[model samples]
Each structure stands twice: as structure tokens, then as C-alpha cells.
Target: MPLSTLNKEQLSAATAPIGNNLIIASAGTGKTSTIVGRIAHLLQTGIEPSKILLLTFTNKAAGEMLERVGRYFPAVVVNKIESGTFHAVSYRWLKQINKNVTLKQPTELKTLFRSIYEKRQFKRLNHDVEAFSSTYLYEQYNLYQNASLDGFDIWFIDKYPDHKPLIDIYMNIIDEYEDTKDRFGFVSFNDLLIKMRQSLLENRREMQEVLVDEYQDTNTLQSALIDSIQSNSLFCVGDYDQSIYAFNGANIQNIATFGKRYNDATVFTLSKNYRSTASILSLANRVIERNERIYPKKLEVTRVSKNYPPKLLIYKELFDQYQAIARNIKNSYTPSNDIAVIFRNNASADGVEASLRELGINCKRKGGNSFFEAKEVKFLLDVLSLIVNPKDMMAFIHIFEYGKGIGTAVAKEMFECFIHFGEGHLFTGMLSPRVFNLPKLNPTKNMQLGLFDDDTQIGSISRFAHLKLSEQIKSNPILKHPKLTDDGLIFFKNFYDFLKSIKNVKQPQTMIIKLINTPLYEGIVEMLSNQRAKLKSGEIDPDKK
Candidate 1:
């Protein structure tokens, strides 16, 4: 990207003396092109690649910028420029001092917190600690660190005074967790930011210039982390109107006050809109202008050609909305150019996808995994597969994975043993456990378990006919596998009871209501419901999976 190729505003901003520069770039205004031009101008001024640092929200953004820069400079020179997200760069900095530094994801940290929490004698506390789920408390601990620098106790007390009673215990638990992390050289995403700032406070400048992307969508904690950088120059590009992460702790004021924070900051507006027509920008401006303006800005169209005005359509039902969209797209869509159907939530996406399919239009998704691809869904499907045909070895092995201490290899071994005992079908072998009397296993224990030699192993084998499912599980030859454990396998026993109840029913449903009515499958439903109760804030079933 050459400086001459940039618009006048972009050129001025890119080549301006770099002290404290803030580029107020509106959406689709070639912000990336300005950044590219800026990079070229910096290199043209003979600045060393290592002295320039580019910080992006995602590693992919940094990689894209570098790849574009590489086209203008030698690969060796381009690669040397420090480029990465805050977490990525901080990890490298922290790793230099502690070779054992390790990063843990939110899921892993939550599990760790729960384990430590369960060991405490919270029952004795006047405040019912059990009232708050471990997941909710863990999310709050993270929320405090990510959103604010205030003391967790103060923050919790000020916002959720009712939770004040249990705050001390949570604070202690979190303190213990943090100490454990430090002792083990473990750091979460927020920890990397927190520790890196502390490190920078004690160090001299390493990079002379630091560039921050998506400044408007950064939280107070992140903004503080950026301010702690010991760089001589700061280049931040953001559009306050584009800020959309408030729910995740993003502060709109970070960008709004950038000029005031850096008194010498020079502001430039990238107003030329390359992506939208004048009609769209006009409506956009009208809608956003109604909001309070911390820093005034507007979008200007680049193209002089006339374009279609934006249309607003209303529908009475959600399904009707999707149907209308699908009908319109079906008539105008070109095979060479794909049409996009953007939805805010997965549930809306599902509706649009179904409508499109009904109209015989082929579409593919790009964001998250499909609904059927979830682990729980696949597990349920496996169970359904097993119910349809007990001889399904694959389904058997998959379901067996839920059994405590049973891996794929062990499950496979169990499957073979079941098939061998059943003589052909898995249910036949399970219904009759007397084959264990042949004795590679304990015969006296089988007698103790009330599992005896059947009248015949061919059909309707004898095994705990007089006992309940729980008793049968204890005596079942398959469940008593030498390699299997005694616990987690209990769920499988419940599933067996389910299979027996529905053995004669032609029509079966996976509905929770139906499952809860069964004495056997009700346990599975309850366990799944408990798992769902652990969902984090703003997490839906799709995102949870």
C-alpha cells in the first residue's frame, strides 16, 4: 500500500509525525488501507521493524496486516515487527522471565475453581454458599478482573449488595486459586494482561511505537494495560459508533477520551466510505446521530453513482420474516455470487437456514459449528442408534465412553465381550450374565451377586430377573468388566431400564418431557439438567456446546 494511493485525509494521518495519533475511522472507510499506508510510511522513514509494534484484537488481524506489509517489504524485515494480540504478546514477555509460563482457558479454570470450592465446608457459613452455583461465582470472579480494577469485594458490594455476605468466602477462594496459579506458573487471559502491566511498570521502553486496533471495544482493564506500555508513540484507530462489546466489558469512553488522555494526540477522520452507498450511509448517520456524541464524526460516500435506497420490511411472525427473505433471495440470487443471510443469534440462523432449504436453495454456514455437530447431540444420537439396533458396536462404544474409566480401547474390548456372550446380539448377552460362570472371572462373586447359570444361553438368559435395575447392574457381567470402574457406569444401567420400557413401543421421542416420565431415563434427564445449570452468563445451549 503506497502513501500516494491513500486519500488526502488518510495520507495526512499516515505520514503525520507519530507522537499520539488517533484515527477516527468509520465503518468500511478503508481503515485497513490507512493502517497499511501508515506502516509503509513508517518503514520509509527508516524506523527499524523491531521498534514498531502492532496490537490487534485477534492474532488473525495482525497476521493479515503483516502479510499485506510483506508485499511492500522484504519477508525478513516484515516478520521482525512485533505483532500479536495483547494476550499473545504478553505471554511471550512473561515467558521470557518464567520458562514454565502456561496459559489456561476459561473452561479449564472454571473446573479447577469448582474442585477447590467443593472441598470447603461452606455448609457451616451463615450465608448459603450453595445458593450460588460455582459457574456463576467463577464468571463473577472473571468479570471483576476483566471489567474493572477496583477491589472485587468493593465492586461486588456496590453492585450486588445482597451477595455481600458470601463475598468474603468467594474472595478467599479466588485468592487461593490465584496463589495456586502463581505457584504453578499458570495464567489466564486476564492474568496475562494484569501481570504484563505490572512488568511494564518496572521496565524501560522496548518498542518505540505501539499501534492499537479496535480501541473503542476495549474495557477499562485493557485500556489501563495499553496505557502502561512504555512506548514513545501511540497510534489508535477506532470508531466509537462501531463499539459493540459492552456486554463483555468494553468501555466506549476508551476511544472517546483518547485525545484528552494524550493531550498531544492528533485526530484524523477516515470519512470516505468504500463499502456502502450514500443512501445507506445517510440512513446510518441519521440513526446513530441520535445518540450522544463524545467525538463528532460522519461518513462520506466515495462513489458518485446512484444506488438503491435501503428498504425496511415488517413481518407479523418470525417464520414469515425468514420466508420472505428466502423468497426474495431465491429470485435475485446469482450462482456466481453467494448471498449472505446474517442473523444475530443461532436460533434465528436456524429459521433462515430451514426456510432457504425449503425453497431449494443451497447454503453453507461459516461461523460456528452446526447444531447437530454438538457433542451432547452426537451422544444422544448414538443412544438412539443403539435403541434401534442393539448390535450397533459403534454406538455401544461411543455410549460406553461416558462410563467411568472406560476409553475407546476399553470400550471396544467390552463390546467384543458382550457380543461374544450374547452369542450374536448385545441385549441377549446383557440379559443373560451367567456366561461369566465359565470362569475366567470370579464364580463365587457371581453367586453372591445372584447371577447363576441360565436354563439356556440361547434365548431369555437368566440374570437378576428378581432384582431391580440397580441390582442387575451390580451383577451384570458386562458392567463388571475387570477394566471398568464402579461409579460412572451407573448411568448406563439407567439407560438399560429405559430400553426395557420402550422395547415394545413403535414410536419413541427424545423429548425431555417423555424422558423425565420414565423411572430409568429420568436420571439421565436430571444429570443433563444439572449440567445445563452450569452455563455461564449470556451462554445459550449452542454456545455452551
Candidate 2:
């Protein structure tokens, strides 16, 4: 905890005059350590802990900082330092004042976009528009909002005149999305910063200092939010060379222009390498020096030099390269060696994995395949859950949608009914006499009916059970005798029979196999087969497989 223990540059940075300071912290340098020391120095200098804010780019980094502060300082210092990601801190601040804001998750946003697209009958492009909307459009929207631009559509059309038709369509989607969110009183992840900045401008909070980590990775909105919140006292630490998040709207110029933007900002460079040898540092410096617009800082290695240059291997083909790699691992590595073969993409590892297996080298993949995401595994689990607890609406919905007549809309309605009532409510509601006798409305007045027919009321259970109920209504003489279309006797009988058949099936594998052999699974298999055929015929990229 002593300030004297830090390197001269670190100690100076930790205890520097705290008026708009930027620390260019290189990789392998003690950036986090410097930030923690700075916080400790501030606390030791009689600064109110609550008036100091520490922001990171991730929850994990924030947590790590908190943990380190706790380890190095007293509990009082740890408790008073407000620390979190930018979005988290902004959201917490807004929530404290009772803002009626809802944060849309990525999945929720994608679903909303898909729903709007389907309803509007938009012409489909070959590219994944949902993905494009999320990544490119989302970033551009935030940038536009940050810059206070009101006419992004016109700007985009003017910029890309050749693609104006598609751009116009996209602009409509964005307009519809904005209108929808406004009507529902919803806010997105980026809206948190926009609103936070607005609130701060109206009524600035009493914060004496703001320290941001990974400043180079901040987007324009985040940078604006930081500027709004910090009252001439800012300490940002990041390396411009390490900025690689431009795809997500990270503006490297934020770091590059810090001094110019904050005219009185003091800048410091921390370029001492502590983790790597001199040879490695030299090689890295040589490679990065080629960049035309780099911050001029040379890393001085403090560790003992390995004295050996890095080795490079070349082969004629991917399989040959993988084979050589496998041979090298088999000959040079032991079971205890902590080695990794990193690849740019998961598909690139196929040849390496095969080669490694041929050489009998055991390796494990880092990520893939959560048990719940596997189709066969999830189906069986859903069935088991339904059998054990019939009131499990999620499980019931999944199983129900597998039937012939049940689609997502019908299943959602069933789920809603189940939520309002108790177990087996969906079945009872579907079979109710009230639903069967409901009068239909005009088509124009029944836009809310969704995929159902215009004559079908919202609660018309028989219409939902079209194929499933019609088959039973004709095939079973007993069901026909009940005149029970009004009572939903036929639908109830069919549902109960289906549930009962799967209830006592003790062997999950057998149940899974049986389910796979059904029409639903056959359809899925055929779709997959057609996709593979397309890939084989060069209509689709094999790498996408």
C-alpha cells in the first residue's frame, strides 16, 4: 500500500494533479495497479469517497478493481468508491430518481425488429438484416444520437445514393422502431447514456473526480457522458495501439485527441513491459511501428531476455500445417504443458483437431454447446419438466408448438392463459364454451388477431386447434357424439392423450428417438439437408457450415 513501492512513472501518475489527466498505459504495463493506486491516493488525500467515480468497460473489470481496492485499502475506502460499467452506473443513477425506463436486451430488440419486418412485408435482402441492424445500424444510431444529428436518414441517403432504395427501407424500419419504443415508454442500452447525459446537463451531480479505464474503447456517446459527469477533474487510462473495437463504435481518436479536447489535460506514458522478455518486446515494437498514426512510446523491457527470436512455420496446405503442428506438440510438449492453439475462427480448428486426434494428443475446446441449447437434449428435458409440473408454461409451450396446428401465436396465447389461471388452464380455456360461441368481427377492425382468420375471435380456441381438433373431430366416433366442439371435449381428449403417452416414458433416449422420427424432426432434417446441398453446390460458403 506504500506509494514509494510504485515505479517512478506509476507513482507520479498515481499522485498527479487530478485536473483532466490522460495516462497512455501500454499492454503488460500495470494499468489497473496505477488506477487502484490513484484511487487510494485520492482517498488518502482527504477526498470524499462518494465524490469519486471509477468506470470500466466491463462488469468483470469493475469487480476486479473493487476486489483489489478491498485487498489494498480499508473497508471505508472500498465501500465509498462508486464503480461499475458505464451503462450500469448510468442505469443505476437513472433508477435512483425513479425513471420509467426499460432496458431492451439484444434478443428482445431482435425479436421486435423481426416482428415489425414480418408485419410490414418488407422485401428481404440476402444479408442478415437483423444482424446488420444490431451491429452497424445500432452503432451508427448511437453515434448520430451522441452528435445530436436529427437527419441521419437524409445524411445516409446522400452519402450512399446508389443504395438509396434499400437505405430508405432501412430508415423506415428505424422510424417504426423509434415510434414503437416511444409509445411503449421503452429505452435501449444506448438511451441510458443519452438520458444520463441530459440529466447531468440539467442538474450536475457533486462528483470531485471521474476515472475511466480503457478510455480508448469508449464510443462517442460514452465519451460525451463522461465529459458531462466529470467537473474538470478526469483521469483516463488506455493505450491507443490496443484499441480494436472500432466495429462497435469505439473511437480511437478519443484517446488520440484527449489533450486537444481538454486543453489543460496533462498526459503521461507508461510503456515499461513487466510480463515479457526484451526479444518479444522488440519484435512487437518493430511490428507496431509500421502504423502511420501511432502514439510515440517505446516499451522498455524489465524482465530477463529469452534471447531467442520467435519461430515461424509454413506449409503447403491447411492439413499439412495442422499435421506439423500436431507433430511438434507431440514431440516438444508434455501432458503438463500449458499450451494453447488459438485460431481466428472455430472452423479453422477442424483440421488441427483431426490432426491432434490422429497423434493421440488430448485437447479440449474452450467454448460451445450448452446442454440446454442442444435440440434433442432440450426436447427431452422439456417433456420431463412438463410431466413433473404441468404448470410449467415454458415447457408446455415448447411441447405444444411441436403439434400440427400449434404455431408460436397460438402457443403464446395458451401461455398467457396459463399465466392468468392455474395448471391445465390452457387446455380448459381452449375447450370453453365461451370461446366456441364468440362472434367474429370485421377484418379491418381485427388487426390485433395476428395470423388468425378475420372471422376468428381472440379467444376462439377451436380456430387455434384447426388441424389437431379437425382430425380428432372426424376420426373418433366418441368425440363426435359429444356435440362437444362447443365444450372443447375433442381438443381436451387429444391433448390429454398426447401428454399421457409421454408422461410415463422412463427412458429419455427412447423418447428423444421417437420424437426425432416424427414429422417435425423430418422437416428439420430435410431443411438441413437442403442447406448442405446448397453449400456443396457453391451457392453457400462451406466455411459457414
Candidate 3:
């Protein structure tokens, strides 16, 4: 932790003259340590900790830096040194300026975009709107906003002519998205940086020194925010060769052109590799040197090489590849934690996972569907949200079509009707005679109630049959008889009852637990179990056979 303990390169970079310095921190060359040491030096040099800002790409990284800084420095200095992700710091500043400011979660924004996409008519495309309106679209929007593009349509058309058809639709979506956010007084993650930049410009509160980690990963907006707040004493650490997030709007040029941007900038390179062996470092350097534009730096491995030659295997087919990987994993006696099988995408993970499972090995997939984004999880969360806030029309619409037969069109119409009548809740609206005109029950279908084999369907029907639907049926015939299938009616009634049961329960965890114990959870579990069974049996090949 001492200044003398650092290698010559690290020590030099960490204690360099602080005006507009750029530290080229190659991967695993003590980047975090350098940042920590730099901050320590700043505090030691009679600089006010309050005036120094350390910005990281993730909260985890910031936490690690803070933890290390606290260990090496006094609490007085560590506490005063503001450190956090760019978004977190921005949000804090924005909140300080306006206490009432609120941010919309990514999921909520996506839902809003999806709802808008569904409501509007546009030229049909091969892609599903739900699939098309994802994080990628949001990233594109952020890029355009950051670059200050006047017209995204022209920019996108010029850049990607094949996607020109989607340009107009995306523009419309963006318009609706902006209007909705304005109405709700909501700001997005990207908006945090933009708003923070505006606030800093108006307030003109400059930091004594600003330190940025992973500077290569920064987009234009983040760079702008940094420029707005920094007092020209900037220390940025990044490796241009390691800038692999271009798809996410990261500009490698930020690192490549840093010296040019700040003419007086002192550039330092930390090329001592402490993580990988000499052989691995050689391969990495060879591969990265192929890049047309890069800051040249030779990495020298400090660690002793194992002298084991890397193996490359060729397979005739996808299954053969999976089998070979599985065999090697088994033969090597590698613990699952120490072993990593990476692929091009999530689709490739399925086959590897299947192969591992077939070999009686359990492997956890990292970075697949987020817990909140999973279909079953989302459905339950929606149901719980609807129970707590019945006016959440999106939640109501989502849950309305949980069971088969109640398609999107039907659900949309029902929601429109509820809104037209100015109803209090969906259940209350369904029971209204003015809203739904129910018909007589079909005797044949009623008699065939228990004939269904599916437990899920039978359970739903049983719940619906027990509900007092006479009042609803009298008002709307569509709500009566077999038109609303036993399965559909049952799910609706049970869900309504579940909502009512948790109506007074304020604890979200309690509600979630209760919801998870319901038949819906069981159904999801059973479905997944069946899918796994099929996968192992080779009915659904992991290799996409």
C-alpha cells in the first residue's frame, strides 16, 4: 500500500503532475491500485478531499476503490472524496439540485415504449416490436442525444441503410417516449448525465481534480459531463486496445485522442502484466496489434509462464464441439468456478449448459435473462403491483392475458372499456353491467368441467366456478358461459382473490412469497422441469440440432 511498494511505472503514473494526465492502464496492470494511489497522493499534497472526484463505470468498482482507499487513508479524507458510478454521481448531484426529481427504471421505460408501439400503427416489419424495442434501441437513442444529432432518421439512414425502414418508426417511438417521460416527470439513466451537465453549467461548481476510471468505455454524454464539472485538472485511466464496448456507444477515441484533446496532458502507460502468463500476454498483444488505430504499448508479463501450450480443437459439427469441450472439462478435473466456457451470445450458452448437464455437471450461466425480466417473474410482479395499485393499467393489461384465449386484442379492448367507464379497478369494472354484457352459461361445457387433464387449466376453472359471476354475467354475456374458457375465468377469479387477500398487506416480500406459493408458480416450475427433461432427452438439442 506504500508509495515505494508500487512498480516504477505505476508509481510514476500515480504521482504524476496532476494537470490533464492520461494513464494508459492495460488490463490487470494494477489499474485500481493506481487510481487509489493517485487519490492518496492528491490528499497527501494538501488538496481538499471534497474537491476531488473519482468516477467509475460501475458501483462495484467504486465500492472496491472506496474500500481500498479507506484502508490506506483516514476516514476524513476517504469520506470527503466523492466516488461512485457516473450515473450515481449524476443522480446525487441532480437530487441535491432538485429533491423531487425521479428516475424511471429501465423496465418501466421499456414497457412504456412497448405500449406505445402496440397502440400506434406503422409499417410492418419482420421483427416483433417487443423484440425490436430493447436496450439496443435505448442505447441508440442515448448515442444520438449525446452526439447532439439534429435528425436521427438521416443519421441512421446514412449509417445503416438496411435499417432505414425502421428509422421513421423509431423516430415516432422516440417522440412518444419523450412526451410520456415529460408528462410523468420522469428522467432516464441517460438523462441523469444530461441533467447533471445542465445543472453544473448553471451552478458552475468545479472540482479541484477529476479522476475517471475506464475512460475508454465512456460515451460522448459522459465525457461532456466530465468536462462540465472538471476544473481542467483531469486524470483519466484507460486502454484503447481494451475498448470493446463500441456496440454500447463507447468511443474508443476518447482514450485514443485524450492527449490531443488536452494538449498539455502527460500520458503514462502501465504495461506490466500481473494477471496472465507470458504466453497468454504474447497472444493478447499479437491479436490487439492488428487494430488499425491504437495507442502502442508492449505488455511484459511479470508472472512466470506455466509452459503449457494452449490447445485448439476442430470439430466436424456443433455436437462434436460440445462433446469435445465437455470431455476436456471432465478430464481436466477443473472446478466449475475456475472454469469458464464463453460463447458469442446467449443462444450459444444453451448448448453448453445442456452438454454440461448431460455430463452430470451443474453450471450456472452468467448474464442471461435478469430475474425481473423473466416471463414468470414479470407476470407475478405485475399481479402484485396491480393489487397494490389498481390504477396501473399496464399491470392490469399484462395480467389479463395470462391464460390462453384472452389474446392481446381482447385485453386491449377490455382495458379501453375500463378507462372509458372511468372505473376504479379492473375487477370492479369487470363486474359492472354497463361494461360487460354476459351471456348464459353453456351446460355442455359446464358439465365437462373436470374432464380437462391439465392441472393448470383445471385449477383455474375450479377457481372461476367458485367465484360469484352471476352479476358480471348478467351485465356482459362475454363474461358468462364457455366464451370465457374455464381456464381463463378461473385464472382471473383466483388472481382477483389473491389481489384482495394482499390488498392490506404493505410488505412487498410477504406479498411476493404468498404469490409464489400460488398455482401460477407451480405451473411455471412444472413447465421448466418438462423443458429440462426434453432437453436432456435430446428432443430439444442444446446444439440446436
Residue range 1-545, candidate 3, lDDT tens digits = 64656899999988988699999888989998898888888888988999999899898998888888788788877888888999999999889888866686776666556655553333223433333444577666666766542577776666667766566667766776687566546788888988889888888877889999999899877888888884858989998887878877787777778878887889899989899887778888888888775566889889875765566788879887887788778788667789999898766778888888899887888786677887778887787776666556557657765565654434544554554443434556654434343221111121112112122121122435565664434244334333356666656556645655675788889888888887766655555555665765557544432
Sorted on lDDT, best first, the list reads 1, 3, 2
Q: Which candidate, 1 or 3, has the higher lDDT?
A: 1
TM-score of each: 0.69, 0.71, 0.74
Residue-level lDDT of model 2, residues 1-545, one tens digit each, is: 84656798888899998698999888888888899888888888889889989999898998887788787787876888788999999899989865666676554454444434333223333333322333455555555655443487775656556655466556665776676566545678877888888899898887889999999898777888987884648999998888898877788889989989997888888988898877788888998788765567889999884576778888889878889989989987456248789877777788888888998998887777698776555656776676565555446556555544443334434444433333334444333322332222222232221222422333333333555445433333222221134333433454555544555577767766665665545554454555665755558554544
Best by TM-score: 3
| TM-score leaderboard ranking | 3, 2, 1
TM value for model 3 = 0.74
Please give the lDDT score for candidate 2.
0.67
Off by over 4 Å in 2: 98-104, 123-151, 166-168, 179-188, 333-337, 375-545
